[model samples]
Target: MKNSIAIRREDLNKKGEKRVAVIPELAKTIIEAGHNLRVQSQKHPETNENKRAFSDSAYADLGATITEDIAGARVVIGLKEVKTEYIAPNTTYLCFSHTHKAQIKNREMLRTFKDRKTTLIDYELMVNADKARVITAFTYFAGYAGMIDTLWTAGQRYALAGQLHPFAAIPQSIETEDLNIIKKLIQDIGTHISENGTPDDLPPFINVILGQGKTSTGAQEIYDILPVENITLAQIPEIYANGDRKKVYKCVLGITEMFRLKAAASLPAHTYAALTIPQKESHYFQHPSDFESNLQAILPYASILMNCILWAPQFPRLLSRTFTKAQWEQHQTLIAIGDITCDPEGSIEFSQETWIDDPVFIYNPATNTSTLSMEGQGIAVMAVTNLPCEFSADASTEFSANLSPYLPGIIAANYEASLENSQLPEAIQKAVILWNGEFTPRYAYMQDYL
Candidate 1:
């Protein structure tokens, strides 16, 4: 109903922080790893609770060319996926958090990788599920409270993976082993639904809700009735405890409709409500009509919240996004966009950094080549961008002013490239071809079918 923040100058710059702060953190990790971390951002040595966890630069030494723009930092990383501009031909990139998109994008920047010329190593493949589970959960919850879309989007992605099945609800009467299998399947189903769902497509997959049966009534009662005993036997409880029953039935109807018409809605309305927040926080609380789009960015990582909050208690951020009153009220909405999430106490922000300079595997068609760049020597790091929510743009311009000092140049560079038709430099282009050939092609292939 309001002007999209994307069109707002101040809001756009504020949203641009995603790119502005990555470099210094990457540099910090590199520095800690005993490597040099340089960035263009005006740098000052600062640390936080998470950063404090790292050993006192015991294992590695890192230095960076600090810069105000994250784009510059990303440029130094020599990662092609983030930008398509320059190639530090000789600079070896070491990064973690490798994704298919990043893989292809990097290859685009370093064209030499596919020519049996360069190297790209994906260290993320080595990460165990446990580690991913920890970080994933925290981000997922933040995605929910903040109305981030990527979290819910994960279900749609899984559907694209060909992991969807008919609605098979977990039965209360089933054996523990059977229930476990159902749980796994449910998780898989959820993943597919999120990853593949679109406004035009089917809801992605069917949900099988196991109605409360007499045999396993206890568990069912716990899930279905909640704080109430089986006071009476009725078609449904007084209220849908967590809206589970209603969602399940709706899923059944949606799935049936999909089969009949060969089409499905992007998502069921019931589930969508749980997945996103309704209250839109004004960005920076400055403009009254700076609303552009709802924050649908957290969908891909939705399950992360369940994992972090229920499964792994080690991580703290699964609770919420840390935002100051100013930030909360500033933007047209309350939540952030992508993997970046706020902390539990709403005091800090954190995000997973996997592929800044990951070992990139690429294939070159120009010279009929395969290449590896940034192999093995990758770094894994997390960033605590702006102070949780304490520093607000309206309260004081200090944050805006100081942000440039800590912002990563890579962020700026990517923003610039995004505006420039998403083109990368020559070398990076080759690298991207190879990267796409290996990783992105898998998804791209499926997309072709879709």
Candidate 2:
């Protein structure tokens, strides 16, 4: 039985990705379940100390082998996209490939997957029959850290503009020891805002959060702790007019509010309006081109924008570059944007890649130019590509628990057999983009990329 499973160390290309796929506790679980386990070491030629939350000896203490070369392992699991050179042929690999939307970056990697007869199981595509996500720990944590980092940048942006606010006191997520510490500091900030109201020099703080899924929920969990008022979209102008400086105004924009039917005016009276909420959502999703962005109504008043929408090309961009430049030309009130969706111009149209070390860049809507400087005129965009890795230990612990239940089936899956004769769980089978050298039917549409 080729029952050995290994964890791949993140490659050098992953600049700030400091997470391990398998932590010590999960290593023990895999070993206890009657499988040989190996984890890649972080050290150069096996250094005693590494950056992982757990020591390498911890895995060895749990009756697991620690080595650098996971390439020979029959089954390898990891986080993020595997480096092209590190991808081994004829092995079953599990990770987020980021190739689903036909990303040009991974086009060659997909070609490699086909040519090398690799069996790739993408963690991102592991959805049920109805498209409900099964593994979501990473997403929630990503939002959790994203919000914290958002505050960090928002505070800096304010300080640069010489504004007096409590947000300037908040620290980045990576600076904290853990999630609890981050919460404590934010709670203290909330208390401060409660005791002393925000400065009158600045306009009303109208914070907008896009999307209501786990990612948005996690961000709101942190945001709601602040002295804030949750407002409806219709009440935005009222809040801006007579809102309290002691409180931050929060608004969540879902798909229905983000987009409106472009053909609504052409339809008969109460035609699109008569449809149920679900019906409207389905109609927009099924025919995205029929809708146009309705986000401009809220943008001019928003102080901070936290974007967490699931964006694809078919759907309209949450903020088009053209719209952003035009909107800023009139009344630009946006201060900072926490683009947790981090698709680099996919959702927040001006969002470009920023790293953990230099985590923020100022995107100038006026000039359609960007600079890494925190000061000057532009919306400070905090688009850290790997937010979850800032809370790597916490994220990994939750991920280990979520992956626990599915481990047995994933380990026992028969990848040697043909896709038709395979014994993988139905959900897992559906996530397999490549099974035994051939692209799965569901992913056959990716053929055009090659």
Can you give the TM-score per candidate against the true fold? 0.26, 0.96
User: What lDDT, from 0 to 1, does candidate 2 have?
Assistant: 0.83
Over the full model, what C-alpha lDDT does candidate 1 score relative to the true structure?
A: 0.24
lDDT of 2 at 6: 93
> Mind giving the per-residue lDDT tens digits that candidate 2 earns over 196-304?
8778888888889999999999999989889889899999988988888888889998888888778553444367789888888887788787787888888889988
Model 2 lDDT at residue 408: 76
lDDT of 1 at 428: 31
lDDT of 1 by residue, 1-450 (tens): 010000000111121122222223343533443433434322223412222112223222343332323321222332113232322232223222233333343344434433322223222222233333111211222212111122222222334444442222222111221223434555554454345432232231111111112212222221221111222112222222222221221111111111111023244345433432222111112222222211122122112111111111222222123222222333221111222321212212223232212212222222323234221111111112221111121212222232223222212223222212433322232223224123233233322221
Per-residue lDDT value at 16 in model 1 = 14
- Candidate 1's TM-score reads 0.26
lDDT of 1 at 222: 18
Kindly report which residue pairs in candidate 2 clash with one another. none
| Candidate No. with top TM-score | 2
